[model samples]
Target: MTTETVAQALLDAQVAWAINRLTGDELPELAAKAVDDVLAIAESTTMSSLADPELIKSIARTIAATVPPSTAASTLVEHSAEVVLSNPAGTYTLREVVDRDHVERITDEALGLTPLVEKVLDDLTHSPMTAAIASRFVGRIVNDVVAGNRAMAEKIPGVGSLVSFGTKAAGKAIGKTGEQFEAFFGDTAAKGAEFAMGRLNKIIIATLKDPATRDAVLEVFDLYADKPIGRLDKVLSLDDAKRIGGLGQDVVITAAASEPVLKLVDALIDGFFTVYGESPAAELLDELDITRDILVEYAVAGAPRVFAAAQESGELDRVVREQLSPFFSSSEVAAILEGR
Candidate 1:
């Protein structure tokens, strides 16, 4: 027959075979047999395979070495760097990435805008470490106050003015100007200051011992909790962003390229190859239950979907055309067609 006639005859036979066999009752039985054969072969192979410990160990070692932690970390870093370089948004400033409102809220929460501060203070003061530190501080302050009172009692009229002047000068030198000290002592410094110091010392001791003092301290902290010290908007500029981004890139690149890191990479590569090369891969595969079962199950479950997709897209026709088109002109295929 001519080439065109042969092609036409093959096409006619294909259509007939598809209609007869594909639509027949034998299809389900064929499918069932295929599944059973696959399962049986898998069970026999897998059971024999996993019985070898060395194979299991070797495969485990190979897999472990193939994806060493250092290598994985380096790969991740490289990928991250590449992504950052490619994306315009990656060049965002610290200010852009940082939510000032969220930060302010966090600051407020941490500083105890509400009862949070009191709870934190209560926890800290109640803890042995904080209590011990506070106790030591209180003891030192009490000692100094007591000593000062005694000194004042001995030389109340004489050196009081000198002490006051010297104290004010020291405070001024430190840029404090004694405002806080003045506020604490008030006019009491002029009116029986020694009596005031003794009472203040007693008050300090009482405050340390009192539970209400924790709440009082927290309440005081809350006053400054959400108060903006400076403009958050002007915190980071474009120049600052560029500088920071460049510096970060330099740090990451430098760390990755360091001699220690290179040595680590070499060591990891060498160790992995050595371990994997000497491993019992097949025996390891035997012990592990990673069989064709999962694939088979997926195939069985997804058969209807596969069929629907193939029917919808004519994928089966395309595949058959692609694979069997050349074979149609072959003598063996011609003989097979004649027999059919």
Candidate 2:
């Protein structure tokens, strides 16, 4: 046969061999060997050589820009909500998902932000809007109480007429003087409102700082932990889920595109590179607790199903032939076959 014919025959044989090896009983062994070879290479290669921080940042930007439409987000959320609502109430309890220690830790960490809470409370209490609201609220309560007392007094048998006359007269006199009195004591009212708000802030701060607060949280968690997650359709309708999901998606999309979020993404990527850039890829995998055996096991378990599908689609033969054909058709292979 001619050199070209010989090369073509060899290429066909090589492709067949490759397909047989991938599909035969020795497939698991091949997979294990391949994994071992990859890990061996990884042991010599650093993570930065594979993926740099800039690439990761670019990927983040791409993901942020490629956010799905709100309608799609809403549909997905609605479907997820339906699936969740259809599940049994006892599918998973809070206690099963999270331990008491984790709950306690989270609660303690949140409640430890006393300074932040105090600052927020101080801002609210000292605001003009809050003072005005408090003053109006107190005035409404006082007026309600007086009206209630007058109503009750008018129900009395003998003194009803006299009480009614005195109330009307008092109301008229107060109406004439009330505006002047308010003008005179406006500053005092504002101060009083501020004082009331300050008192409320103190109470709120005290309640948060109380040791019993933690216990109360724990008790509430305990009460909820054992209870099965009942149907949530009544609490959160599908329409509500859709609306919330769309809004959440929009918010995420907007935030992810914001300068601060982009900066944060870059910072995180840089931090990761700083920690792992120089380390061998194998060491990084080890740090993640992935071992050689686990890698082999996963490869072996997943290979058959993937190859089966590829073979069914005739893709395995096509890929094997495609990979081998280039080598056989090269000038080097032709020269060797021709005894050059």
lDDT of candidate 1 over 259-304, digit per residue (tens): 6765566566556445544444433334466455554565556555
Count of backbone clashes for each model?
Answer: 8, 0
* Candidate lDDT values, in order: 0.54, 0.84
Score every model by TM-score: 0.30, 0.79
Name the regions of candidate 1 deviating beyond 4 angstroms: 1-7, 15-170, 176-288, 331-340
Give candidate 2 regions above 4 Å deviation.
67-78, 88-91, 125-196
lDDT, model 2, position 116:
99
List the lowest-lDDT window of 10 residues for candidate 2: 65-74
Clashing pairs in 1: 49-286, 50-286, 50-287, 55-283, 55-284, 56-283, 56-284, 112-117
Put down candidate 2 lDDT per residue, 111-194, tens digits, no spaces.
999779989988987787796786577668778998898788879887778878888899899897878778898777678788
Q: Largest TM-score belongs to which candidate? A: 2
